[model samples]
Structure formats: structure tokens, C-alpha cells
Target: MWYVIQTQTGGEEELVGLIGKIISKEYYEECFCMNRECVRKTEKGQEIFLRPLFPAYIFVVTDHPKRLFLQLKRVPRLTRLLSDQEDSFFSVSEEEQIFLENVQNEEHIVQRSLVEVDDEGMIVKAYGPVGRYRNAIVRQRLRKRYVCIEQDFWGKKRKIYLGIRLREDGKG
Candidate 1:
């Protein structure tokens, strides 16, 4: 199961750094923080940066949430595990889970997609996670180099932007 853990908004990296030191060995290797590569505009030029895909949340894929939580509960900066009941946890909706899996490449890094749009401004083809949901794309930002995909997650329409080729020229 994939579990979401709540942590201080800007402190996810710090908390994740302590995982292996505090959590049980069985769960430590399975915990991860989700992030994505996106383009950012700077004074000099555009640069690529890695930012959290989901803010304030870190995902851990382990069957032992409670067992894992017991050891992690006291860690500083951690808020709580997303759960509805005591000692029990529920996973993100199936679709969201699948999205996470699809974004990751062979090395387990979430790859930044490179996409090309026609002169008419329609997405022609993409290579990476963004490609998988071309049909769901609702917005495109050539300046920012990301595409917004709106889809159903837990019965609600959640719109998220994934990083991609951020310009009309599709060049860095």
C-alpha cells in the first residue's frame, strides 16, 4: 500500500533525511519523497529545478504503516500520517498511485518530459509521464515549460502541472 505522511511544508527533505536513521530497516528502504523536474525562469535564462510534486506530503509504499508509524511518530517536524482511523491507514486513490508509478523511469527518478506542440499550439507528441495523459491536458504553459492535466482522483477533479519542455521552440 502507498501511504501519505504529513510533514512541515518546507521540511520534507529534512524529515526524509532522517528516515533511515530512525525507522525500522524493513520500512526505511521503502519510503520516498515525490518530486518532479520543472523549468524555472531566471534573470539569465531558464533553468531546470526539482520541486515537490505534492506539497507537504511524502509517500511510503509499505504494507507496514502502523509499524512504520510507531517508529516515526516522534520524529521532529513530522505532523501525521494521512489516516481516518487510529493505528490504521488508507492509501491514495488508485489513479494517483498509478500516476506516481508511471512518472518514474528505470533509475527511479521522475523524468522531466520533453514535449512538442504543433504551430497550431496543440500537443503533438510527448515523451515521459506527460505523454501518458495527453488526452487529459487542460492547459499548457510554454513560458513555464509545464502542462496541466486534469483528471479524476478520488471522485474529484484535481488539476496538476507536470514539468515538460517549457517553450514554443522546445529547446533549452
Candidate 2:
């Protein structure tokens, strides 16, 4: 089962990590992961760096929803788990959970470029999350010219870095 646990602003990943540890201590055969971007300082000064494919959220897999909730409630920084009736827990689709996991575990390239796909199926270097659900390339900075994009699945968007593979026409 999957549940959306609401956490305090900017503490989503931390709360998720805490949940993972607590579950492990209890010997619960469950797993949890939060999609977060890692930012670092380089010769180019400070960069916004990577964006968590899915920020402010974490996907957890478990069988005992009640027990999970009970355990999760004690975790600090977590506001509450999103439920349907404020009592009934909400579960996420397996496919969606897996997708989140993949993004959390994959390696991506960091380019000063963004991915742009137009109505003509043309992919170009554009700026910002412009398309529906902010999937389009977002121009973050103009001076250093840094572009970042997170992969989008319909209405849901996740942080995804630029790909290294160039298109046949030298575009990505």
C-alpha cells in the first residue's frame, strides 16, 4: 500500500527518511523514498542544482496501513498523512510508486540546457517549466544561463535532469 504523508514545508524529504528508519527498526518489510534534488557550489558560484523529481513528497510501500500510520504520527516535521475522510488512508498506484522510486535512484546529466518539446514534436533548448504541469524547460537564470526541467507525467511533475544523449539533429 502507498500513502501520501504530508510534511512541513521544506521538511518532506527529512520526514520521509525518518519514516524509513523507524520502519526498519520495527522490522517492517516496507520501503520509503523521497525525490529530492542535490545542490552544490562549484567554480560557477551557487547553482540551484538538481530538483527533486517529486518535491515535498515521498512514496512508501507497506502492507499494514494502520500500523504504518501509527508509527508515522510520531515522526516530527510531518504534518499529517493525506486521507480521504481524515480517517481513511489513501493509497497510491503501484506503477506511480515505482516511477517515483526510479527517479530517486537514477543518474542524470546536469547541463546548462533545458528540454523543449513543441506542438510539432520539436525538442529545443528553451527555458522554464512552460508546458502543461510545468513540464517544459524552465529558464532559471539568465546571467549564468542555467536551465532545469523535471519530467512530467500528465498532471504530476517530477524533478528530472537533462539527458546526455543528443538527438540525431544535435538536440536533447
Candidate 3:
């Protein structure tokens, strides 16, 4: 099962490292922050970058949540585990976990999607993770080269923006 840990925004990487050192390997299978690939226009040319998909939150795969929680106390800058009450950690729902597992790659990065749009600025075809969840798209920001998708994350509705490279159909 995957458990969520909240920490300071922009401190996810450092917190993950801290947790790894404090927690025993037997208690957790993996600890990582999900990332998304984005294309940025730099002075040199187009550049790709990775950003946290869920800022301030990292995911840990563990069967023993109680033990992991206890060990996490020693980790500094960690906010708290996603829980309903004291000492009771909540794992992501099966549906949410499946969606996350499907969209992210082995490195836990959601790669930028390639999309083809018609003259009317409508997405005609999409490839990659975007293609897999086309119906979930709530807004298309073609000018910004991304789309906002509404997804149920951690039992709440979240609008996630994913990078997309758009090419006009019938043109090279």
C-alpha cells in the first residue's frame, strides 16, 4: 500500500532522504515524490524540466504503516502523515493508486504528452498518459502547452496540470 506524507513545500527531496535514513528498510518498500515533465522555452531553445506533481507531499510504499509512522517522527521538517486520527495513517484508495501507477513511469515521472490539435484549437488526438485519460481533461491551455485535468486524489478533487506538446494536424 502507498501512504502519503506531507512536508514543507519544495522540501520533498530532502525530507525523503531524511525519512530513508531514519526508517528501517524493513518497514518501507519505497519512498519517492512524484514528478512531471514540462517543456520550457529557454533562450537557447526548448528545454525539459521536472517538477513535483504533488507539492509538499511524498509517497511511501509500506505494508506496516504504524511502524513507518513511528519512525517518521525522527524526520525533521515533515508535516504529518495523511490520517483521519492520531496514529492512524490512511493509504490512498485503490482507484486513486491505480490512476497514479498508470500515469507515472518507472522513475515516478509523468512524461510530457504529445497531442495533435485541429484548426479550431481542439485536441484531435493525444498520445501517452494524456491519451489514456482524455475524458478527464477539464481545460486545455494550448498556448501554455498543457492541460488541466480533474482527478480524485487522496479522496479529494484535484485539478492537475500536465505538460503537453501540441502539433497542428495535417502539418509537419
Q: Give the TM-scores of the predictions, in the order they appear.
A: 0.85, 0.53, 0.94
- Candidate 3 local lDDT, 1-172, one digit each (tens): 9999998899998888887887789999999999998877789967889889999999999999988888787776656888999967889889989989988999999988889888898988998888889999999988777898999887689988888987642222
lDDT tens string, model 2, 1-172? 6666665556655676677665554524544444333335579854445444445655555677677777776766545666767557777766655554443343321233343445554445443222222344443433233334555442476544432221222434
TM-score of 1: 0.85
Residues 1-172, candidate 1, lDDT per residue (tens digit)?
Answer: 7888888787777777777567767864566677777767789877777777767877777777777778787666646888777865767778778887887754445666778778876779887888898888899886667888887654478787788873454463
Clashing pairs in 3: none
For this target, which candidate reaches the highest TM-score against the unseen true structure?
3
Better of 1 and 2 by lDDT: 1
Error of 2 at 5 (Å): 1.1
Look at candidate 2 and give me any clashing residue pairs. Answer: 37-52, 53-158, 53-159, 127-137, 127-138, 127-139, 128-137, 128-138, 128-139, 129-138
Which pairs clash in the backbone of model 1?
Answer: 145-166
Show the lowest summed lDDT stretch of 10 residues, model 2. Answer: 162-171
Q: Which candidate model has the greater lDDT, 2 or 3?
A: 3
Sort by TM-score, best first: what order?
3, 1, 2
